[model samples]
Target: MASCTNWAAHKLVHAWLLAALLVTLLTLSPSLSAPACGVLATVEHPVEAGRPLRLLVVGDWGRKGRYNQSRVAQQMGKVAEAMNNIDFVVSTGDNFLDDGLASVDDRAFHESFVDVYTAESLRKQWYLVLGNHDYRGDVLAQIDPALRSIDSRFFCMRSFVVKAGTVDFFFVDTTPFQLKYWTDPGEDHYDWREVAPREAYIEHLLETRRYNYLDTLGIRLNSGSATELTWKVAVGHHTMRSVSAHGDTQELLQLLLPVLKDNGVDLYINGHDHCLEHISSRDSPIQYLTSGAGSKAWRGIFQPNEDKLEFFYDGQGFMSLEVDAGLAHAVFYDIDGQALHNRSLSKSNRQHVDQAPSLVSQE
Candidate 1:
């Protein structure tokens, strides 16, 4: 009996050691390691044949339907219905206010997103990037694959690419570029799980010339045999150029801006400021568009910047982009479903032709 008991104990010890070794090997394996910054996940969104691609962009609004979040969503739904056959929605982060999701099962996710944008027309896939506010909480929870089970529309990632016909939208993770979030976080806690060693991460993401991970995206623009013009749009949570409360994210301007410009990115859409704005870059053809007026917005918080402020509105609103083979139209609508500003850009001329804000007759 004593010998049998000792044998059982030895077997148990051996099993424990084997399990520990397996876990360590799995953790150390490069295949099981965290995704490299250069490897941006790509998702293909099919655009209807012979139809223009339409998408709504909203940001900085996860306040549980408060601060006109519901209102904006309602307006979005109305606009989406009117447009008909909308492709998808692009959320510029700040999906949750104060902090991000506590976990994948956090009720706030359903309350702020699922319940708010309940329009049948607004039930398309939502591609999202991470904002500074989103990094304060459980960052992994926001991008967890499990959230899709709760709501299929919930799609968030640190950085990814959305390919739709002639357009390729490069959604970049800009929160890690900000130095203050690391050195002087004040009272806020940032979840930098996969983004430690900031220099290596950013370098891999924006590497040009040698590896040319992101820059090569432009090459594919003219690769096909069709005569359709290809468009490149860069989306992020921080502003590379702005004339609002968070006037300009210096870190992004210094690091990300050059890469975008070099890569022939036509538009840089972001939403850090709590307002809707459009600024044309002085040096490049890239247009800076902000549609952050999803929830609370600053009343009179405007600052001077070098770029041309094409339009600025300090009220709650959302923006829409309609793109076809040759032209792209962008419009900003106020809370009451009125068009505050609209612009049309042609692929041939690439000129910014501003149109007067026309009112959308209410239903």
Candidate 2:
């Protein structure tokens, strides 16, 4: 009996050792065993204890507060207050419909945004990017800080970074990256008032050292920030990969995806296809989230790819995210505030982490 007990103890020790080794290997291997993509630049936003970060994401929603936009906003308020603290809101772009804002004083601003999202909880800062529809109007007017003076909530920039707590949100101007918009308009009308001569925009992205500089900065910031590395997220108006009506944005896949992949980004959020979707690629663990169902939805207009698609809802709705040090939770809410789907990710289970022993518990 004594000999048998000793043998069992030895077997258990070996089993634990093997499990540890497997965990180490998994942590080192990039998701799908792919190479890392970009150099991460960190933005410093300290998260306070007991105060988790929360965000409301919407897109393609500017329509003079008509349709489902008002209903979505109302639900957002209820969700925000329930979450206790919502840091801010994120507009995945297409902020205006049909045509972009004509001027800083464009009444569409009030009608579409100001008047629609009247919930006191939603009065916080709104980080915005430009979409194709927005580029159809005056691009310069949308980013003008003067709009903030009129209403403190409107915050739009071509490309900027917002760091809160241990997360860095990189907002990129994806509309200008697509060449077809400039080379071929066909029947569509584009204002090009401030975004004219297209070459300048393209050159800035390809030739200039702007993005490269950010890459270096991200590396340093991520290394030195707080105790653990901060999570990185890239926000654009278009998607790198999707199974929606728009399919995939080729330009973004080629130019931007590598950067996001290399920087170990956790999520890429966008809104061009007018639907809510979640996609996960085996080649990389970066999640592609779409929340463009603010005002209108494409109903069943989607081409489903089982390999890439995780969840998809064909209706008008919005998305909410709550982030903490150990986990990130996401949920989709319909226009009537009904919870449809929810997903959660633990930090230890992240594909980019160095070790993931706790992932076993998550399973």
Number of backbone-clashing residue pairs for each candidate, in the order shown? 0, 10
- Model 1, residue pairs in steric clash: none
TM-score of 2: 0.79
Candidate 2 off by > 4 Å = 1-48, 191-227, 305-307, 351-363
Candidate 1 weakest lDDT stretch, 10 residues? 13-22
In order, the Cα lDDT scores of the candidates are 0.77, 0.71
Taking all chains together, each candidate's TM-score versus the true structure is 0.84, 0.79
lDDT of 1 by residue, 280-359 (tens): 99988889999888999966888879999999998899999988877788999988888888888877766776563432
Whole-model lDDT, model 2: 0.71
> How well does candidate 1 match the true structure in TM-score terms?
0.84
